[model samples]
Target: MASVTENKPSNPWQVWRPGIDPAADALERVSVLINRHEHITAGYAFTLGESARRYAEQCSLGFLLGLEMVVREHGNQAAILGWRHAASTVPQPSKSQNEGEKDA
Candidate 1:
């Protein structure tokens, strides 16, 4: 008997988008963005940009835009999940740094 391994589920944000060719387009757009902005902070900004670009490309613009609206209306939980994945393997700070914030 051959052993089989189960495939793990993809992230909800990733799964939320559908189709193939469109997804590829989105990824390409995202790659262009990343390449353009490589000098920016190597963190969340870059990550989210890529993720959004992918979602936009892979899914219909309406779907991506609707998701944004849903996120805006519903609050940031879903969006945050997507952002977290894009940011990096290591977790980035959840809070924005303020001028008043003292370094630890």
Candidate 2:
């Protein structure tokens, strides 16, 4: 049988977001954002800037917005990897595929 493997952290995404560093993730996401749009508009700048500015002010929102932008600009795979990296800073509790499925 092929067992499913899942990564589960004791902390929620919000909790994970705070401890993780945002600079590298932000840069990577912002790079993708900059590449996607040839012409940068004020709104675009605002969205990107706001995401960074508010990250410290509002960790959850900033983290979510950053993830959303990355997913929008890149893809879900990138977002998934990004999330994994973000969560790497924290200690995660491992769960088997079957166990994770049951929880879901």
Candidate 3:
């Protein structure tokens, strides 16, 4: 007998910004740093150095993801705040037109 299963739509892991690929850039920079560090530790024989490298990579990944989230949140907040301030200061069109009229 064959069984049927329900499929769910795939969700995006990160919100993308126009003209910027944060994940790709983060991964690329991390790869470069790992390679450079590996080259410098080429003569090391202890697991301590390897462990430290692993920890650093994990920390870098976390930091990059957190930074992206913070930036998105802050950008949204700033836009909303600006809009609120602008709305409050805007004068009604009728009020402006009436201000220049004088009784005949």
Best by lDDT: 2
lDDT values, one for every candidate: 0.48, 0.49, 0.38
In model 1, state the lDDT of residue 25.
48
| Candidate 1 lDDT over residue span 1-104, tens digit each | 54343355556555554454565544443443445444434454445454664555346767667544543343334344554354345344456564336564
The order by descending lDDT is 2, 1, 3
Clashing pairs in 2: none
Question: Model 3 off-target regions past 4 Å?
Answer: 1-19, 38-104
Residue-by-residue lDDT tens digits, candidate 3, 7-82: 6444443443322553444433334334454443322312222222233333466763553343334323332233
- Error at 63, model 1, angstroms: 0.6
* Candidate that would win on TM-score: 1
The reply for model 2, stretches above 4 Å from the true place, is 3-19, 39-41, 53-104
Which candidate would rank higher by TM-score, 1 or 2?
A: 1
lDDT of 2 by residue, 32-95 (tens): 4556545555455445544433332334666666555664554333334444444444444566
Collision count for each candidate, in order = 2, 0, 0
Error of 1 at 70 (Å): 4.4
| Regions of model 1 farther than 4 Å from truth | 4-42, 70-104
Q: On a 0 to 100 scale, what is the lDDT of residue 47 in model 1?
A: 52
State in Å the error of residue 43, model 2.
Answer: 0.8
lDDT of 2 at 78: 37
